[model samples]
Target: MLQRLKLLEHINPGAAHRNVADSIPPPQLHKMSLPYNKVLVLGATSGIGLAYAEKIVEDGKKAIVVGRRKENLDAFVEKHGKDKAEAITFDITQVGTIPNFVEDITKRHPDLDCVLLNSGIQRGFDFAQPETVDLDVLDLELTTNYIAHVHLTQAFLPHLQKQSKQTALVYTSSGLALVPSVKRLNYCASKAALHHFLLCLREQMKDGPGNVKVIEIFPPAVQTELHDEKHQPDIKNGRQMGMPLDEFTAESWAKLVQGDDQIAVGMADRLFALFENTRQQQFQKMVEMMKGH
Candidate 1:
C-alpha cells in the first residue's frame, strides 16, 4: 500500500494534497438546453456550418456567419436578409488574430449567446509512404480543425460567461472521432482530440458559476464538399456519398432543439451510443475511483 502510494505520488506529483474531485465533478447525464438567441458560427460559408447557420436563422435566432469566402458570406446574408443573418469574412486558421477577432465580435454583438467552432478540412495521408505525405497539409488540417478551436474557446469563454443569460460553445466534430476512417487519418485524429476536449470542458463547467453549455455535434459523412477529390485525392464523387444535406440539417436541428448536449446525427448516432454505453461508463467509473485517492 505504501509502495502504491509512492508510485501514485511519483506518477502525479502532490497527489495526496490535491483533490481531483474538487476540480471536476463525477460524470452525470443530463439534458442540456439550447436557448441561445444570437449565434456566431465560424466557417459558415458552406457544408454543415452553413446548414446550421440557416437553421439558426429559421428558428428565429440571429445568425452571425463567419467564413473566409466573401462571396459565399455575402450570398448567405442576401438570402437570409440582414435582420435574420449577418456575415463576417474571417479565416480561423489565422490563430494569432483570434483574441482580437473575438474582442471585435463580442463588442459588436454583445448579445451573442452562442459561438460555434465548425471549421474543418478532410485530407488523406499515407504514413506508410512518408515521402509522399505533405507536412504543410497536415499542419493546416490540424491547425484549422483542432488548434484554432482551442484558441477560439479560450478567447470566447470569458465573453460567454459574462452574459446574464445562458450561453453555449458548440463544436462540429465527426463520427470519425469515435470510429477511425482509414482514408482520413488526420481528420479522425483531430475530431478525436476535439471529442476528448469537449468531455473535459463539459465536466469542469458542469457546476461552475458560468451558465455555459459545451455542445458537440457528431456528424457522419453528409453530402458535403469535405470529401471532394479536389481536397481529398483518394475520394472521388464524394459529394454524392452519405446522407442528404437537407435531411441531415433537419434531423440535427431537431436533436439540438431537443436539448441534447452531444448531438449525433444519422450513422453518428450509432457511434454515439457506443461511446455513451461503453467508453463513457468506463470514464465515469475511473472518475469515481479517483475520488477515493
Candidate 2:
C-alpha cells in the first residue's frame, strides 16, 4: 500500500509537469536579414551625424555624407577613403533647392536605402533678456532645425517607397524635448515638434503598405562643436559635462544596428524611460514653467 501511494504521487506530478510544458508555447524564431547596402547621412559634417557616418563606413558599407561645408565633407571622405564614402555639399535650409538636390543624389546612387536627418542648430535664449534673442537668429534656427527636415523627408519618401527592400529614415532629436532647458527655448520646441512629427509618421506608415522604418535618436550631451562657432557663453561644454564622443557613438551605433526604433545613449536612456512614464503631465508642466506663468 505504501509503495503504491508513492508511485501514484510521482505519476501525478510528472503528468502535471508535462501538461504545463505543453501549455507553454515555444519561442518564436526571428528571421535575420540585412536590409540595405547604401546609406545617406545628412548633416554629416559634425557631431553625432559625423560619428554615424564613420561607423557605417567602418562596417564596410557605403556612406554618402551630405553637408554644406565642402572642407569638412572633403576631410571626412579623405579619411574614410573615396571607395567607401562620398561627400555632397547642400544646405538643407534652402527648401526650394532640395527637390533638385534629392533628384541629383538619387540619380547618382539609385540603391540608397537609408537616410539620417541629423542637421540641427542650438541657440541659447533669455526670455527675460529679449535683446539676446534676435529675430534673424530665431528664423535661422527654425528654418534649419525644423522646416528643412520636413522638406527633406518629403523629398525622400517617394524614392524610399520605390525600393523593394526595407528602408530606414532616422531623425536625431534631443533629450531637451523631454525635459526642457530654460536657456534653449527654440531648440527644445523644435525637437519636441520633431518628436511628434516622427510619431505621427510611424503611425501613418503602419497603415500604409511601405516597409520603411522610422527611427528617432535622443542623444544626451556629447562633446561637439555645435555651439562653439555661435559664441554662446552660457552654453555648457558637452565634453566636460558627461560621456565622451567615442563612447556615446559606440553605444548608439550598436542600438541602431540592433533595430531599436528609439535609441538613447547613457543618461538619455534612463531619462527616456522616465519621460515615457510621465510624459503628459511632465510636458504640460514644462510648458507652464517655460512660460513663467
Candidate 3:
C-alpha cells in the first residue's frame, strides 16, 4: 500500500518524475472534441475511469457517473455539484438491462453526446490447475469486458445518429488485446474480440450517414487499482514497470481532446508495431503461396 502511494506521488500533477512516452496518434487522425458537456462514463468510480472523471471535472464539464456501488456514486455527486455530476446505478454485467438503461440515459439527458465504455476486468488463469478454473469468474470477465459494451453501443447508436451534435462512442480496449498474454487468457481474448467488433461496427457507421464517431483507446499498463491490486499480470512495460496514473491520464486526455479516433499510450506502441509487422509478413507469405497455386 505504501509503495503504491509513493509511486503515485512520483507523478502527481506537478511532480518531476513523469514518464512521458512517444505514443503518437495515427498520422491521419484529428484531435477529439473534448470537455464533454454531458458524457456518460461507465465504471466512473475506479482506476482509469476515475482519473478520466477527474479530468472532466477539471475541464468544468458535466458527466453522468455510472457505477455499481450506490455509496460511491452518491459521494461523487455530493462532492461535485449534483447538477454537474449526476449518478446512475448500473451493473453492466447485467446485460439484459442494458437496452432499458440506454433508453433511460437518452431520455433523461438529451444533451449527452458521448458514451465512454471503460468498464472491464482482468482475471488470471493457470492451465495446469484446470480444476481450479472458476466458470463464474470467466463468465463475468467475458460479459463485462466485451459483450456488455456491444449491447449498450447497439442500443445507443441509433439515437446518436438522430442527434444534431457530433456524438462519440468510446471503448477502452487493452494493449494486451493486440499482444497476447498467457496470464489472463480470457481477458485478452475478450478485448481482442471487442477490438475487432469495434472495427466492424465503425465500418457500418461509415457506410451510412451517421453523426456518431467511433473511438478506440488502447491503454498500456497504467497504474490502477484494478491492475495493481486485482489481477496483476506480467504485462510487459517498456521504460518503466507501469505508467504512473497521472502521466497516463494526462497523456490520454490530451489525445482525446485533440480529436483522435484511436489512441495508444506508453508501451502500447510496441504491441501495435509488432502486430502490424507480423500481419504484413503473413499477408506477403500468403500472396507468395497463392502465386504457386
Best by TM-score: 1
Instruction: Give me the overall lDDT of model 1.
Output: 0.89
Task: Provide C-alpha RMSD values for all models, in order.
Answer: 18.9, 8.7, 14.2
Better of 1 and 3 by TM-score: 1
Q: Supply candidate 1's per-residue lDDT for 86.
A: 90
| lDDT tens readout by residue for model 1, 122-143 | 8999999999899999999999
Q: Each model's TM-score, in the order given? A: 0.86, 0.81, 0.79
TM-score of 3: 0.79
lDDT of 2 by residue, 1-293 (tens): 76765676787755533555687889997733335578899999988889988888877788899998999999998998889999999999889999999999999998899999999888887879777678888888888888999999999998888888889899998877677788888888998888878876875676456678999998887777766534566755643555677988888887888898888776668886776547746755765576543
lDDT per residue (tens digit) for residues 1-293 in model 3: 76775777776743434445434555785534474577889998888887887777767788788989889878888888876788899999999998899998899888788899999988787878999788899999999999899899889888888877778898898888788788789999999899878766776677455678898888987777665433544443322447888898888888998888767887776766767557646755765677546
Tell how far residue 1 is off in model 3, in angstroms.
Answer: 72
On TM-score, who's better, 1 or 2?
1
Q: On a 0 to 1 TM-score scale, where does candidate 1 land against the true structure?
A: 0.86
Separately for all candidates shown, the number of backbone clashes (residues 3 or more apart, or on different chains) is 0, 0, 6
Residue pairs that clash (backbone atoms under 3 angstroms), model 1: none
Q: Where in model 2 is the C-alpha error above 4 Å?
A: 1-34, 236-239, 277-293
Q: What C-alpha lDDT, on a 0 to 100 scale, does residue 6 get in candidate 3?
A: 76
Give the candidates in order of lDDT, highest first: 1, 2, 3
Angstrom error at residue 169, model 3: 0.3
